[model samples]
Target: MSRLVACLVLLALPALAAEPAPRRPVHTYSIVARDPVTGELGVAVQSHWFSVGATVPWAEAGVGAVATQSFVDPSYGRLGLEMMRAGRSAQESLAGLLAADGAPGVRQVAMVDAQGRVAAHTGDRCIVAAGHVVGEGFSVQANMMERDTVWPAMAKAFREAKGDLAERMLAALEAAEAQGGDIRGRQSAALVVVSAKSTGRPWVDRRFDLRVDDHAQPLVELRRLLTLQRAYNAMNEGDLALERKDTDGALAAYGAAEKLVPDNAEMVFWHAISLVGVGRVDEAVPLLQRTYKADPRWRELVLRLPRAGLLPDDPKLLARLTGAKAVKK
Candidate 1:
């Protein structure tokens, strides 16, 4: 029953279970946060309900992040972001929504706006082992959990953890699980992060949006997806470097992407191509060989690159790269 002072009043209200129960009782643990250094806003959640990712997490760049669960009402996420987008703070937006709701006592929701103001609510009618903790730039909340320690452990982890918004939020989720997470056990999870400022393009502003729709171990799969996202992020940086004609910078970025997923053929092939384009054929050979051995289609793709003006038209170089001809002294 531990909770922030603001939520005490809500807890004192009569239980709303007299009304019909929400069809989707998405009881879960979640956190909404704004990164102090990057100004990025994000929300992460794990639940026993199926596909919690689809309903629990919502965020808008330069506005706020929201997590709505327990007896979930998805309108909280949409309307909360709408309010924050219209200049309302997270606290103001959540308070207004709760005030107008017919059954606020059954909902669990948290929000963190771009400016880092955070607020949360855990309705009195929520199941046992339920509570919330609001910190400087974040709010950690949980309902129907294995223990009351879940949200506090989440808050502590997010406070002391290092890294960007996505990583820190993930740390909070991991901590919740370490405290015996959802009472019914894990099913689905989601993590979403948006830029500090909007780019006017919705797709571009969504930095890291990932979900594990259904998994026996949702948190573990979510972390793996995050790693893959980072690798692809490095690849994009490499592409940007190439556009800038910074060959050395491109190589460094590509090398990083390759190291992140050494077994990924796409990353290995691109790193090899970048190295060869820089006239570091010797360094490129091993990487090319690795990809070619894994799938002969990569060698075929290399052969087509010359005709597309992406590679030199020299037959000798192509032969040597494909391992058909020996490297010259």
Candidate 2:
């Protein structure tokens, strides 16, 4: 997308609300799920707490995802994944972490193993309304909620929701909020999903990590970011198709990306450039003209392309593309 699209979104962000004077207690609702078909593991969370996901959620490709909340022991995230990686089931991993921690009574946690088996705990010491709901391939947990129905609502939402793992996890978060989310209010949210198989390359294995550090409507912002992510994914696929000389596939990918963000000038500029690469200059002309009219800088960029060998070196093509007078050669 054009830098303008991103700038507009950024500019639309509201000023940060005042955070707690001290890093005091925070409570939240979150879900960890494994996609049955893709084996993709994901966790989504929202809280009345600032940067809630920074400390609350963790995942490792081919291992499991973890959310350690309530008294919030960050170790559970690290240790649970480690234990599971060492061959422990989700139950065993959680048990081992709770056993090692002296303050288990005050902590709440959940884990979904690589195989989809889930285990969770809600300590009696966690704030009132704290509890968890375990369902097939997923678990929803909440504490200090507006009502005890928060976790249960999340459970039902996950069960009934349709789409990819991220969307379902998001639905659960939305359900939690609808049922009465954090008694205090809303702040930050995050989503993390990883591939089921260990690719050895961490970056390649991990997918869809998004966060809204602090926002009045964190979930709403999270959804917008997710939508933007899908467009970029389509753009990436289009790039790869072009690399393989699959013109039809490339165009289809660009078309899908454009459809996602119809007004994204940057996306359209690249789409037009791609058409030019495929010798579809006539079809690309209108797109380029619209792009250039909005910002002549795009025309300057196109003029530079021939020097970079990214576009045809022909003087006629360059003049037509840039709307510049033909250079007498």
Candidate 3:
């Protein structure tokens, strides 16, 4: 009986020693910065886990961007934006918030203002190899890096890269990866860029908002999407020119956009509008008819246009433009 008990005790001891401690909640860490020339704010992050976009990356059109990660308290994102809006400097805002948090040691964050003031924090009790670096108008922070060089590499990329705000942010992500990112591997990535001018229109105010929810190669796919976004912008410019009756300018812009994305329905629809603006009604009729047939709501809009003074007063011209029966309002 004593020998059997001794063997059982030996087996139990090894099992207990091998067991890992129960994991506490995870917090995210990231870099937030502003562009001096454009005043565009951005945030970039990498995590050992999946789909970090939900907990990280927050921004309002006119307010500063925020990245709340690493044993995270999500409230920091909202509170930081409020603090910045309330006239607190980035440094003061971060310091005040972290000082009040019970788990400061596990949180990491960085913020930059439109005036180029920057602030960053990396809690002492954070996982090993976590640190942050801040420079003129930029900040880079990382946790679970393979070495201390991750943040410095990111800082260098942000300063040296020549591109728009989104490109600069992407460079930082690439730099972190080159310096041994997440100490695990990549899963997801996201980028968002908002114009300094709100224009009171949310859809048009945001310049670039792209996400790679789950991918083996997120950054590469993100670059491709940005290219498509530029093409769409061209299409919008063409539509605006058409509205002003600048037929030549509208054609040039639409041609450039269509060359980039030829199959897009909006591009095709707007190009047809440009043709019509220049009195090419015969050419416009077929394209508009195709679009109307594909979407019945568009047909309804066409029927309502005569009453709104958008369509010609002549019944014959209206009938020729829309083959379907027109109901006089």
Task: Pick the TM-score winner.
Answer: 1
Runs with alpha carbons beyond 4 Å of true place in candidate 1: 1-22, 325-329
Q: Of 1 and 3, which scores higher on TM-score?
A: 1
Candidate number with the higher lDDT (1 or 3): 1
lDDT of 3 at 310: 47
Instruction: Point out where model 2 deviates above 4 Å.
Output: 1-24, 307-309, 327-329
Question: Per-residue CA lDDT of candidate 1, range 1-329, in tens?
Answer: 11332343243223323333355899999999998888998999999888898989999999999999988988788778877887778887788778757888999999999999999999999998999999999999999999999999999999999988899999999999999998999999999999999999978888899999989899999999998999998898888887787777878888998999899998998888889889999989899999988999998898888765567888889888898764322
TM-score of each: 0.91, 0.88, 0.72
Residues 1-329, candidate 2, lDDT per residue (tens digit)? 33433332233222111221122465889999999999999899999888987888999999999998887877678767877787778887776666555677888899999999999999988998899999999999999998999999999999999999999999999999898799988999999999999899987787788999999999999999887777888888888887787877777888788788877777787788788888899988888888887888998788777776567778898888877789433
- Between candidates 1 and 2, the one scoring higher on TM-score is 1
Ranked by TM-score, the better of candidates 2 and 3 is: 2
The root-mean-square deviation over C-alpha atoms between each candidate and the true structure, in angstroms, is: 5.9, 10.7, 12.6
Clashing pairs in 2: 2-266
Prediction 2 TM-score vs. true: 0.88
Candidate models: Cα lDDT each:
0.87, 0.83, 0.70
